[model samples]
Target: MRIIIGSKNPTKWKAVQDVFDTYQVDTLNAPSRVSSQPFSDEETREGAINRALQCAESTPGAIGIGLEGGVMYIKDQLYLCNWGALVTEDENIYTASGARIVLPIDIAEQLKAGSELGDIMDQYTRKEEVRENEGAIGIFTNDSISRRNMFVHVVKLLRGQWEYWINK
Candidate 1:
């Protein structure tokens, strides 16, 4: 089966590749069609769904996957959240959320000030393209869970759901 991924990011590709290892995987630059920095679970999930739908639509007969990272508020504290979506050619959609970590107060403040997490993380870690690598999760978790692994978990959830549905 051909698996179509919605982003060109290597991290997201690697996550999918890890799970769907034997499949013929392909990627296209599908837009999230949401805020560059999604501020809530709803928006983040929407972005993921949009990407998955677009990819599935673009390729008539394949499974499309989208992975998105965002932040959300819980009791006035900001937490980093990730979401993923899988859309089958038959239009079956499966969505799942991954692990989240509470952001430091300083980072939360910056997010409230309208700074995207990636940019803030880059500045915080003094690294370039952190989002495409270990990401804020890695920085916060001390590499206990890299960003790619986070997305890998999400992909596994999505793929597992799809498998269950198809087998049913």
Candidate 2:
């Protein structure tokens, strides 16, 4: 099987690759068609689904995967959120989200001021392409968990769902 990731980001592609290591993997630059920094869980999931569906339609006979990271407000506290989607050849779409961490007020302010999390993190850490590396999660957790690993977890969930559906 061939899996086409909706984004060219290596981190996201690696996450999917980790989960579906046996499959042939490819990456494409699929548009999310949403705000660069999604502010709500619904919008974040929407972006993932959009990317997955678009890529799946564009590449027949291949599964399309999408990964998106965003921020959300839950109970008045801002938190970082991540979502993933998988589009199968049969038009079945599976989605799952990862754990969220509360964001510091300063980071929230920067994001609110129109700075993307990746860019803000890049400037704050003085490193380029933080999103493609350890990511904000790695920085927050001191390298315990990375952005790629977070997506890996979400992809595992999606695969589990797909397995259950196929078996049933």
Candidate No. with top TM-score? 1
Those runs of model 1 whose alpha carbons end farther than 4 Å from true positions after fitting are none
Stretches of candidate 2 above 4 Å error?
Answer: none
lDDT for each residue of candidate 1 in 1-168, tens digit (9 for 90 to 100): 899999998899999999999998999899999999999999999999999999899888999998999999999889999999999999999999999989999999998898999999999999999999999999999999999999999999999999998999
Window of ten residues with lowest summed lDDT in model 2? 54-63
TM-score of 2: 0.97
Q: How accurate is candidate 2 locally (lDDT)?
A: 0.92
Full-model lDDT for every candidate: 0.94, 0.92
TM-score for all predictions? 0.98, 0.97
